[model samples]
Target: MDAKQYDTLQQSLSPKPSIIKNCLKAFLVGGIICTIGQLITFFYMAYFNFTERTAGNPTVATMIFLAMLFTGFGLYKKLAQFAGAGSAVPVTGFGNAVISSAIEHKSEGYVLGVGGNIFKLAGSVIVFGVVSAFVVALVKLLLVTVGVTNW
Candidate 1:
């Protein structure tokens, strides 16, 4: 086929995406996830004697644990398919990615497969998160030293 004809055929064969529908699905799913997290944080603050700042750690850990569980049970993939980027823009998404990799590699062996590959997708995230936090702290320290901001 000629280039122009082939391009036209490809365009005709591909299904068009509905941008508004996808956006609405993503917004609803992502909002629900965030609301669940907020509820967890408040529960901790109210019942566990955790302050707002201290409550965040447990809330994040709980969310990650739940995400990992969902990933293991193969539910997160279905959710991702339905929610698109909505299921992937949170810390829970990071947990899902890491656990999914491990599950995929679990067949080869525990040590060489699951353990080795578990961090493949998440290592960059960890390294970058640590580096970014360090950089931000350094900038804060510099600002304090220069009297641009107070500690």
Candidate 2:
């Protein structure tokens, strides 16, 4: 067959993706994760004597830890498959990416496999986070110097 016919045949055989359903899944899952994070933050503030401002650190740490645990148990991957990008746009998604890489490379031994490869997928995330934080701090410094607001 000619190239155009082959292409048409392939297109006909392929299943169509459901854009609306995928979007709804992503939205629901992402919102659920955010809600869970907020609950953790509130729990820290209400029960752990952490103020609203101070509660974010532990709440984020807790979320990352939980995501790592879920990844380790092979649960996060299933959720990711079902929820699509919804499960991958949050901080917990970062955790899943890191741990999943480490787990994937664990067969090559500890130092070379887990340690070296742990950052393969996550290095960009770390770099972006650090760079963004620096940029924000610089902007805040500029604002403070110009008396835009009190420090």
Candidate 3:
């Protein structure tokens, strides 16, 4: 396009409030998720008598389970509605994606319905991540064998 037209379009599309608002929203949501995790850790230790280490790691697992359960029962949708990425960026989000997909496909019978749907979002990611790790390890070994270890 001509320079004048390009400049006009660029000015028209220049950064605006909508972009800033969306970014602030994302930041707030992420902060809220971290805050929720902290609260869970505190409560686990205070109320459940859990040790510090157990409370930290296991609360995350528990939250993931609850997110899956809620997604299965269609409750997590509301949580996402309220918390936005705050709720959807964690392990809980992974659970929600998995359970929701499984529930969506439940009418297709056991094999495809239950099994196929379980890992719809996460399955491929997990597989590729593991495979890529193996490749990276092999490369590292080869590099070490060649005496090129100091990168």
Root-mean-square deviation (CA) per prediction = 2.6, 3.3, 5.0
Full-model lDDT for every candidate: 0.92, 0.94, 0.79
Per-residue lDDT tens digits for candidate 2, residues 1-151, read 9999999999999999999999999999999999999999999988898998999999989999999899999999999998998999988998999999999999999999999999898799899999999999999999999999767
Of the candidates numbered 1 and 3, which has the greater TM-score value?
1
Q: Put down candidate 1 lDDT per residue, 22-111, tens digits, no spaces.
A: 888889999999999999999999899899899989999999999988998889999998888789888888899888989999998999
Lowest summed-lDDT stretch of 10 residues in model 1? 84-93
* Pairs of colliding residues, candidate 1: none
lDDT of 3: 0.79
Candidate 3 contains a number of clashing pairs equal to 0
Ranking by TM-score: 1, 2, 3
User: Against the hidden true structure, what lDDT does model 1 obtain?
Assistant: 0.92
Ranked by lDDT, the better of candidates 1 and 2 is 2
On residues 4-69, what C-alpha lDDT tens digit does candidate 3 reach at each position? 999999999886657566556667866876777788899989998798788978788877777777
Candidate 1 regions off by >4 Å? 1-9, 139-151
